[model samples]
Target chain A: MSESETTTRAIQVPILTRVEGEGALHVRLRGNEIEQVQLKIYEPPRFFEALLRGKPMDDVADITSRICGICPIAYQMTSVQALESIQGIAIDPEVARLRRLMYCGEWIESHVLHIHLLHAPDFFDCDSAIELAKRFPNEVKRGLKLKQIGNRLLEILGGRAIHPVNLAIGGYYRLPRHEELAALVADFEWGLQNSVDAAKWLKGLTFPEFEAPYEFVALSCPDRYAIETGEIASSGHTSIAVEDYEKFFYEVHVPHSTALQARKKPHDSTYFVGPLARIQLNYHTLTPIAKQTAEAIGIAPPCRNPHKSILARAVETVFAFEEGLAILKSLTMPSRSRVPYEVRAGEGVSATEAPRGLIFHRYRVDGQGKVEFAKIVPPTSQNQAQIEADLRQLLPQLIACDDAKIALDCERLIRTYDPCISCSTHFLNLHIERV
Target chain B: MSRVIRRVVIGIGSAHGQDAIGWRIVECLGRLGIDDVACEFARTPLEILDRCEGIDSLHLVDACIGPESGRLHQLQWPDERIVALRWTSTHGIDVPGALQLATELGMLPTSVTIWVMECEGNLIEGAWSSAWTQRIETAANRIARTKARAVRGEIFYRCDRTSGL
Candidate 1:
C-alpha cells in the first residue's frame, strides 16, 4: 500500500490447535524484512464488567468466575481478595488455610489442564489429548487422572469442580471436614506420583532452539512461587505492590482487536509472564519433590525457553498437590462458616498469582457496598507481546516446513503461555503475503 | 409380524448449554445402576468407532433436536441402529453438523446408538425441570431406560482394556 511498506505481516491459525481460547497470529514481512507480529486474540468478549456493575460485592466472585470456564478460581480468588481488602476485614486462620488449599487445587487444575489436554500433544505432533490417548494411552490417562484429582479437590472444597460456589469474602461457607478431604489424599498422592511420571514423560519430547529476551514477571514470595497471592516483580528489578500496577503498567485497546493490550509504561514493547517467568524467578521456593523433578529434567534453577514451559507447569502441579495436602490436613470447620460483614465503602486492589500468571482485580465500592468501578488484568493479556516476540523468532525457522507443521509449532508456542483470551477478542485476519 | 422399533424417542440438546445434559444422559448410565441399552450424544457418526479398544460391544448416547414435541425418534450412522428420539435441546449447530464434524475429525466414539429428545413440548430452562413435570417425564424415562443398557455393557460395542490388536 505504501512505497516503504516492503514487508507484510501474516499469521493464521486454522483451528489454533493447542490453546484454550481460539485465536490467530498475524505477521507481515517484506523482502527479507519483518513487518508486524500481532498476537490476535479472537475469542468473543463476555462483558463481565458490565455484568458485575449492579451486583453486590458478595456476588462478584461467582459472577466474574463465569467469565472463563477454564480458570474460574482465578476470578473467584482475586475478587475475594479485592472485596476483603475493601472491607479491611481479616479472615480466620482456618479459613485462610482453606483458601490457600483451594488455590493449590486451582493451580493444579489449571496447569494440568493446560499441560495435558492442551499443550503436551504438540510434542508428539498430535491434534488433541484424545488423539494422543490413542497413541500413548497410559501417559494421556495418567495426566487426565492427575487432573481429575485436582478437579475433585475443587469440587469437594469449592462446592463444584468447574465453577466452585462455596468460597466467600470472610471464608468458605463450609470448610471441608478432614474426612471429606482425606478421601482425596489417597488419589492425590497417587496423582503426585503420576505427575512425576507425566513430567518425565513430557521431558522426552523434542524441543526448539528459539529463545527471546522477555520481561518475566510474577508474584514471587520469599518462601514460594506465589500461585495464590504475593508481591509483583519482574526480572528487570521492577517490583511493586499490587496497588501500584496501574502506575507502572497500563492497558490500551488496539484497533484490530477487542481485547485490551497491556504494556509497561513508556514503551509499547511486550513482556512475558506466566509459568516460565514464575518458575524462572522462584525456583528456590519449589517444594522438595518439585525441585527434584526439575533437577531431573535439567531445568536447573530457572527455565527460560518457552518450549520447556510444560515442564515448569508440570513441576508446579507437583508443588500444588503438596501444598494442598498440607493445608487440607490442618483445616477445621470454622466456628461460623462465614464471617458477617457490612459493606463499607473504599477502593481496593486484590491480586493473586493465577495458574498462568499474575491476575489482578481492582474495585471501587460505594458506601452501601455496591461496586462503582472494576478492572481486571488476566495473565494472557500481559503476555500478549511476548507471545508475538516468540512468533517473530520462530517464523523464519518455520520456512520450508509444511503448513501443518508450522501451524502445530506456532500453536505449541502460544499454549506455552496458557493464554485465556476468553474475556476478550483482539485479532486481525492474518494475511501471509509472499513478498 | 417381525419386530421393528415402534418406540418414539425424544432427545434433548445440551452442547450449547452448561452440563451438556443431553450427552450426560449417555454418561450417567454407568452410575445409575442399569444394564443392556444403547445411548449417545454424538458429535458425528462413524461405523466401528464405538468398538472398544479391548472389549467387544458398544452403546452410544448423543444429543438430539427434531420436530417431535416431547417425543423420541430412531436414526443410525456408520453402523446403523435405530436412534430413539426423546427430547429437544439447546445447540448452536444441528445434530447433523455435530456428527459430520466428529466423523471428519475422527472424534466420534465407535459403535454409536442414540435417542433424540423432541423438546418442542417443554424445554428445561434455568434450573433443571421438575421430575414430576409431565412433558419432561417421558423423555427422562426414555433416557433412563436407554442408559440402563449402557451400564450392562450390552450397547458398548467394545470397551478399552488392551492396547492395539
Candidate 2:
C-alpha cells in the first residue's frame, strides 16, 4: 500500500447488469490513490430530437413516450405540458388532478420496482431480484403486488399501462367513471400501509456510512411535493422558472458517453436529482403520513447519503398512494375532457418531477402545429457527473479492499442513483487500473 | 358452464432497429383480420405477463441476437429439450425469465410458444432492414395461419414440421 510500490490492476465488468440501458464503469488508481472514475454510457443514441422535427406537435407525447418504457408517463407528462404551454391552453382543474393521479401511479410503480427488484439485491448481496426473492419471499411478493396496483391505476386512467394512447395535447381522450375511481380507493388504502411497512423494513437494512457534498435539485410546487409540474429548485438557490431551464442549465457532450451530461451554468458544477433530492428540497410539502414516516425513519433535511435513497423512495411511494387516494375522493368530472386550441408559432418548455428526478422537455412548433424542434433532458444524464464524483469520493476509502469487493462497492454506489440508463441511453462495465 | 378458450398473440420488441420485427409481425397479423386471436405489441417482455391471464394459448414474437441473423427460432414450452430458458433484457426481466416466474406463480397459460428472429443490426430507432422485412412476412404469415386453424378447433403446430432448429 506504499506510494513507492507500483501496483497496477484493471477490472472490466463488460456490462453492468440489473440496471436499465447499456453502461460501464472505469476506475484508474495510481499506487492505491484514485486517479479517475468514469461511468461510461454507450447505449446507441436514438436521435429522438431529430426524429421529432416535421412531425405534428400532437404526436410529440406518443413519440417521446416510447423513449423509456419504465417511465413513459414522465415523457408524456413533460411533452404535453410543453405543447400546452405553446398554445396557452389552460387545462381544466379536474384534468390536472387526473394528471397528478396518473403521475402518482407512475411513482408508485417505478419506485417499488427499483427498491425491491433492483436496489435491494445489492444490499442483500444477491445477483438479482430472483435471488433476493429466494430469501425474502413474502417481502418480494408484497412489493410486486404493490407494483401491480400502480399498473392497474395507470391502466384505468391512461388507457393502457405502457405507452398509453389516451394522453393528448390538452387532456385525456376520455375521463374515468366515478365508480372506477372509487374502486381504486380501497386498493390505495391498502397500498398506503404497504408502502409505510416497506419503508420501515428498509430502515432495518445496513447502509454504507457515506455522505458527499453535492447540490440537490428537484421541481418545487407551492402546495405539495412536486411531481406533475413545478419550478426548478436547487439547494441554496432561488426558484427558477421552468422556461429558464436552458438558461440556467446546459448539456455538454462528453467523450465517454453518448448521452450529454448536464451542468448548471456560471459555476458549471455537477448536481444530483431524483427521490433524495426531492425529499430534501420539498420535505415540508409531503403528505402528513409521508412526512411522519420519514421522521420516524430518521430521515432529516439535507440528507447527503445517497445510500439512503432507497428509504427516500419508500417514503415517496407512501406519498404517491396517499395523494392518489385524496385526489380520487375529491375528483369531479370536467365539463369537457379536453379544451380546444389553435396552433401558434411559439417556444415552450416544461419540467416535471419524474419518478427518478426532474425531466425537462422543450419544443418549438409552427403555426400549423408541426414541431420544428424538440429537446429532452432525462434525469440520468444530469446525474451522470454526480455518479462519477461520488465514486471518486468512495474509491479511496475502499482502495485497500480486494478487487472484487471494490467492484461490488462501485456497482452498489451506481445503483444508489437507481439510474434508468435506457432513458438516458446509459452504467456496468467496471475498470480499475492501479499503477 | 364451459369456459371459452381465449387465445392471444403478443409481439415483443422496441421501436428501434431490428427490434421492431415483433411489432412488424403484429401489424401484419392485424391486417390479416383474424377475429378469434387478439394481437398486441409490447415494448418489453415484462409486459407479456399481464396479457397472458385467461389465455388458453399464447404466442410471443421477438428479435434475438444470435449467430444466424434473419433465421427464426420457435420454442414451445413444456419441451424437455430446453433447460432453464433465461432471457436477458436491459429494461426488465427477459421473456424466459418472466415465463418461469409466471409459471411459478401459476399465471402461465397451458400452452405457450415464443418465436424469435435473429437480429444482428444495431437496435437504434429507424427503418427495418431488408432482411428483417422478409423475416417479418414469413413469421406473420405462419402466425396468422396457425391462428386460423386454432379458430377452426384444429390442433396444429406449424413450426414443428419446418423448424430448422
What TM-score, over all chains together, does every model reach? 0.80, 0.85
Candidate 1's displacement at residue A75, Å, is 0.5
Give the per-residue lDDT digits (tens) of candidate 2, residues A118-232. Answer: 8998888888777777777678778878988898888888887777777888888888777888899899999999999988888778889999987999999889889978899
Shift of residue A21 alpha carbon in model 1, Å: 1.4
Off by over 4 Å in 1: A1-13, A399-405, A423-431, B1-112, B116-135, B145-165
Q: How much of the real interface does each model capture, measured as fnat? A: 0.00, 0.18
TM-score of 2: 0.85
How close is each model in CA RMSD to the real structure? 7.5, 4.3
Clashing pairs in 2: A8-A434, A11-A432, A16-A428, A23-A427, A23-A428, A24-A429, A25-A429
In candidate 2, stretches whose alpha carbon ends up further than 4 angstroms from where it belongs are A1-5, A423-427, B1-11, B14-42, B51-90, B103-165
Error of 2 at A171 (Å): 1.8
- Candidate 2 interface RMSD to the true structure: 3.7
**Each model's DockQ?**
0.10, 0.24
Give the best candidate by DockQ.
2
Per-residue C-alpha lDDT of model 1 across residues B48-155, encoded as one tens digit per residue: 222223322233344334344434443345432231222221111123423443454444454344444443423445545554134344545665654455445555
Q: What interface RMSD does every candidate have?
A: 9.1, 3.7
